[model samples]
Target chain A: MIAAVGLVLGIVAGLIYEPTVPTWLQPYLPIAVVAALDAVFGGMRALLDGIFDDKVFVVSFVANVVVAALVVYLGDQLGVGAQLSTGVVVVLGIRIFSNAAAIRRHLFSA
Target chain B: MSRLALGRLAAAARPRATRGQLVAAVLCAALGFGLAVQVRSNQVAGLSTLSQSDLVRILDDVSQRTARLQAEARDLEDTRAAVTGGASGSRAALQEARARTRTLGILAGTVPATGPGIEFTITDPKNHVHADVLLDALEELRDAGAEAVEISSVGGEQVRVVVSTHLVDAAGGIQVDGTLLHSPYHFLVIGDPRTLAAALDIPGGVLDVLHQEGATGMVAQQDSLTITSLRPAPRPQYARPAPASGR
Candidate 1:
């Protein structure tokens, strides 16, 4: 319950502040968001399974975003940025879909 | 065995969510908040412009200005060449002035011009074609060194297209300079045929956009393309050339 309140507070703070992202980090923003989404869905699925681990969730969330951004940065250096970004998005998208599906089944039993 | 039953069995055997569950839920919410903010910012940054037509008009204005600058540069180059040609006599001067006049006249669309170039026929069945699309094609042609361009409906009278021409929406199609152009808009451009054709065929170019929007754009290169249409000389009411100091 405290966590839920913290979550709501974080969302409110984010909306209120509406901070600007730096221009240098602009290219990685979308990829990081997708990675974060994948992590969120995974956490939700774990929670439904009654095996939620805070350490694991935090680690996965940070790692996912960092690795996704790193891959894109490397791709930019190699002159294949667009192709690599597509690859990352596709992988994260599939993960998010599966996790969301599992969460749905756990919640609705359908 | 049903998958749901097996999932239930596995879920029931696992320990109940601990205090860590709260942390994970909070993180998830934070992630959601971040995603929302990111999406909103992206939208605001990308589309602060008013509407599609406004964007197109801005692009058209920029391209027309670029074309005008390029024409001016070409004129300067011709004049420089004439000055450096070492023709000192009055006859040479007269010839140079006449040549410059012809070149400027052609560029200003006040004189007819014919040469090798490419022609385009765009057939829009849905009449949803935008004037900016045609203007983009003209810009591409100009960038590829097109000297003259004339556009008309396939069966209608052609008009000389100038940098200052405005394309307005009509009942059935578009109206360029008071002439209602129907579908299958024909464009005759005089330039390097290879360069002009390549410009249209470039990947993700004008042709690709037209194709994506359900418009059929076709280009054909010709050894000789004639542009017979002419624009009348502008009679400036308030602006005149500055008088020469010695005169």
Candidate 2:
């Protein structure tokens, strides 16, 4: 219960968080949020299925945050935050699909 | 019957552990709390360092603001061009004022600009008197050594800064191509910040009037400031005539 409550609080903090960014680089928030959610749901389902080890969960979480932030960083470098965010979202979407399918098959016998 | 009993005994011997579940739950909760603290600290830090960007961004925003100001100055040249080319009338004057007003909206935010400059930000009009008194304040910043100024609505709404000299719509919106601006004006000046401060303090200046009128405005000086670049927007063009119209 405490863990759930802490998770809730962390999520709220994330929602309210807005890092100082240039005016031209404002569209990455949505992509980051969606990618984060994809990771959480996919990880949670994998954990329930007993197939997602602690190593995989930790690795995925780090990659999600780092990759999302890296895209923004690269976009800022390339003078194209919007474009980088779009690319990041595309990659995350693909991962989500593939991961969800694997988890589904693992969790449920067809 | 002997085999089934033996399997049941084996299952009982290796029942799942509650200790592991409890440990995982506690660890997860600790991680969550730690993340929350980090996020809150970051938020506070982010606010304090407003417009904070990486080095590349810092340079980009400065250049962008400079380009935007240069673009407006070009608009002024266009006005001069039109006038010198013998374009004159109430229509031209109205068009020029409209263009300046739109530029004013965009200029409301202080772009990180360097090279001896002052910045003044005027909060929104709380009353009719305050609203009526803003033009004088704008003049003060200009006389104080401000080369360019922008007056924008709160948060630089679309109505606050349009890119063109086009007439403001009835909604007090400046249209820049398709962008609009609305208020909470920021006036940026690109000259000696201290000299500009003195200019505003000159006897019988608008600052004195505003002090008497009880309006709110703030002026600040910076050794180094950078304004972020506005993302490039699509250029507007005249619509092509249909075949029927051409005929």
Candidate 3:
């Protein structure tokens, strides 16, 4: 319940404030958001499994965003930024799908 | 079964796992914020939603369009310059041809002339004046730059004097180009009046020599005179225009 409240509050604040993302971060913000979504799904699956850890969840969230941005930055320097960014999204998307399936099974028990 | 389910639900709802729950709440908040911000920015900057390859394709299309339009504009400018230049060039040539025609028409004596000149009246009561004496007077006025000349008798018989005009001493009259006339003769001349009058009054000139023939010549300077006599322009049968040479 508290997490749901926090999520709603954050969305409302983001919509109202319209924070300006810096130019250097423009390319990475969407990727970072995708990685964060993957982390949330994984946390939900862990919670359903009765094995959610506070430290692990927080670390994974931060690490997922940072690693994704760094890979994209390296790809830009290597002149294959578009292809590499696609690879990152694909991997995070797979993870989010599997975790979501697991959460659905826990909730519906089917 | 209901009691066991109630006990398990109460345990799960207890605050024992509060630390992890708090962390989960914070992470969820961050996730939601990033999602909302990304969505908003995507709406604000429409191009940000496109992929890198898509943006490159768009840029290529725009640049190619711009280059083609520039070339088209240059072509139009060149055509406009050529059209205006040709129009002006032809206009000047037309004006020059018109002016040349006017000058040629005047010089060919196909048109009447008007200017200041002198009228000479010779009194020949006994008809002692011959064709040679009249010719000398005509020649003298011509030498004084006479532009146009005509001779008329006291009876109003007149002839336009041109380069081909011939004077003959006919019986009882002077026949000028087959037109016979008796004295007193009036020569209507068109030129500088002062010059023509002086040319006639010189010692031993037409006026002085007329006295020996028992004829008296009177000169009157006039401010303006109109010579209405005109001659037909001759067309040459044998003469042809020469071909242009580079030199």
Whose TM-score is greatest here? 3
Which model is ahead, 1 or 2, in terms of lDDT?
1
In terms of docking quality, model 1 is incorrect
- The clash numbers for all candidates, in the given order, read 0, 28, 0
- What are the per-residue Cα lDDT tens digits for candidate 1 across B1-247? 3465456546634554666655666676676667666766777787332233445668899999999999999999999888777556667889999999999888889998989999899999988688888878888988999898999999897889887877888888888988888888999999999999999989999999899889999999999978888989888999989999999
Regions of candidate 3 where Cα sits further than 4 Å from its true position: A1-20, A30-110, B1-77, B115-130, B149-188, B210-225, B244-247
Clashing pairs in 3: none
If the candidates were sorted by their DockQ against the true structure, best first, what order would they fall in? 3, 1, 2
- Going through the candidates in order, state the TM-score of chain A alone for each one: 0.88, 0.61, 0.95
Q: Name every residue pair that clashes in candidate 1.
A: none
TM-score of each: 0.43, 0.29, 0.60
What fraction of the true interface does each of the listed models get right, in terms of native contacts kept?
A: 0.34, 0.11, 0.55
Global local distance difference test of model 1: 0.82
Error of 3 at A37 (Å): 7.5
Worst 10 residues of 3 chain B by lDDT: B1-10
Q: What is the lDDT of candidate 3?
A: 0.84
Residues B88-164 of candidate 3: C-alpha lDDT, one tens digit per residue: 99999999998887656445656777778998999998789999999999999999988788898976787878877
Arrange candidates, best TM-score first. Answer: 3, 1, 2
